[model samples]
Target: MLTGYQVAVIGGDARQLEIIRRLNEWDATVYLAGFDQLKEGFTEAIDLDFDSDQVERLDAIILPVAGTDDQGRVDGIFTNRLLHLTESWLKRTPSHCQIYTGISNDYFTQLTSHINRNLIPLMDRDDVAIFNSIPTVEGTIMMVIQHTDFTIHGSKVVVLGLGRVGTGLARTFAQLGAHVSVGVRSSASAARVYEMGLTPLDMNNLAEEMPECDIILNTVPAPVVQAAVIKQLPSHAVIIDLASKPGGTDFRYAEKRGIKAMLAPGLPGIVAPKTAGRIIADVISRLLKNSNREVDGS
Candidate 1:
């Protein structure tokens, strides 16, 4: 049990509640920050401020999935006040204090490096990404239904990137009778796409494949469906860019072309927060438990 271990849960969305609850159940002394307005009823944890003393006592610092933006400002949906993770703040924490976040930015990485603290990016892990693909596919299907008038059955769908989300979503679309075509850059991935019984197209040939597709889902973080690719697609085509910020599609061109384009980053959190929370909470609890063992030298 984490009876004497102190954990500070910083800004986050609905999923943070699950983490707090799980940590509390494990007997950790928890501090909630950047979440003053949150209606979290976890009695074992304390709703606290960003006091320096608290930071020094913290064994672990939990940050949001998105972590800090380019400017090092965290996304605090629970409170109106801005939550910033600065270099000075890390300096206040103890030497062994480690930070946990889902995904991080270059700015936040630099700060953690300077402080010589362990910055764990959970989303980068295989198990987390694979499990996350379930809700992500479900959320994508929801978006496909809401945005498009056409049925999934017998519709031409192209999924860019044969990665975790792309592969899962493509298989689902194919199972639903949508003619699923996967786009990939690597020959090995293309061979795997063929083995899955889905048509695979190289990213270079996307312009040729664009016009026939009724719906285009891009999982690639890079600019794959820009001006050239957009020009190739039918004006009535639907685009769902699931990449992080500034997604893969050209928003300006899509708008000008009168095509429907959606940039959905954290689909799992939005569509199935409870399930997503549980997934994260399970991983976090195990990590903290292991860390506790390490501290106890057991």
Candidate 2:
């Protein structure tokens, strides 16, 4: 029940609060860093300052979903004070201490290499990503329904990239009676798309097929939908780019062409914060349990 472990939860938004609540229910001693902005009255959590000296005492460190930015700044919405995660902080963590984050960035990678410590990305876990896909798909569908005049039934939906999110989106759209098409890079993925009863097209052929789509959902991280692709699409087509910042679609080109384009990242947190937090807490608690088992075994 995480009774003996000291967990330090660093800054995050509403989702973080849910995690804290769940941790408290599990009877974990949680030290909150940079949570001054959090409303008072969390019974089992202690809000502490961001100091390197505290790093040595923790059994585990939990960062936000985005981990850290390129500049090594962790997400801390509660405090105005900037907590920079430096290599020194990593070095100060005890040898057995584990680090957890949602996603890794350049700064995190650098720290991992420099400190020789294992950094587990909760978002990268297969079970977590699979569970998170439900909210993501539901949120994407909600956005499409909200923005479009036409119903998903009989709408032409094109999903770019066959990753977890894209696959879930395609299935959901198709199940809702939309004519779904999936754009993929490999022939194998194309075959899989066809086997799933969705039309499969090469990403390179997006321009040729763009005109048929009423909704284009892009999961690709790069700029796949440029001016050329946007020009081929019908004016009524809505583009949803689900990639991270600087999303896959060319925003300027879409604006110029009058195509409605949206970049929707972190759909789970937006649409279902409590559910998302629960998913994270479940996975993290399992991880902590397994870690404790290993310690006992050794």
Candidate 3:
């Protein structure tokens, strides 16, 4: 249990609420920031700002899954107020205080480094990524169905990057009877694709191979689908870039050629916040178990 522990959960959407629920169940004293519009009150959570006394005694800081944007502002749907997390504010946290976020940025990296504190990036964890792929793949299928008139079965689908998301998508698409083709940077990933009974195309051959692709799903975070590859694609091909923001597609160029391209980052949060929230809450609660125990000892 998180008894006697003071934790501040910063800006986030629905998933953050589950984290709050889990924390409350563990008996942690939670200070909620940027949730002023929350209709239902959590029995154990009190809405407070950084100026409150609890901020100094905070044992942990929980940030949104998206983390802070490039501008250092944390996104908060529940509150109208703009919450900006700054270096000076974080410096006031206790030395052992840990800040948890899904992804890290330049500001977070530098601030944590200068302050000599630990900032946990949840997205970097394999467990989180693997679990998140469930909702992502579901949402991807839903989008594909809604956007495209054609059926997935027997369709020529090309998936870029054989990472966790790519691997899952490929296998699922194959199960749906779609002709799955995977593009991988490394030879090992290509071998894995072949083992899965899916066609593996190297990055060098993407342009040549994309002409027959009906559904182009890009899992690579870098620009692998350039104008050259874009030009080779059929006019009816749809590009689903599941990488981070901006994605890996040449969107403007795809548009010029009449290709449908979309950038989908936080699909898990969008499709199933409760399940996504549970994934985060489970990991975070396990991590905090020790910290909460230490607080009890202190």
Residue 176 displacement (Å), model 1: 1.1
Q: Write the per-residue lDDT of candidate 3 for residues 17-67, one digit (tens) a residue.
A: 888998898888999889888898787688766776667888889999889
TM-score of every model versus the real structure? 0.94, 0.94, 0.94
Between the candidate structures 1 and 3, which one is better when assessed by lDDT? 3
Q: Positional deviation of 162 in candidate 2, in angstroms? A: 1.2
How would you encode candidate 1's per-residue C-alpha lDDT over 1-298 as one tens digit per residue?
6777789988888878877877788788999878778764667778666655788788888888888888778777888876887788788887778788989888889889888988889889877889999999999999999998889998999999998999998999999999999999899999999999999898977776654879999999999998888877777789999998888999999999999999999898889877887888788767766774466753
Weakest 10 consecutive residues, lDDT, candidate 1?
A: 289-298
lDDT of 2 at 257: 88
Q: Give the lDDT ranking, best first.
A: 3, 1, 2
The C-alpha stretches of model 2 lying farther than 4 A from their native spots are 292-298
For candidate 3, list the clashing residue pairs, or say none. none
Q: In lDDT terms, which candidate is top?
A: 3
Candidate 3 lDDT at 118 equals 80
Q: How close is candidate 1 to the true structure, as a TM-score?
A: 0.94
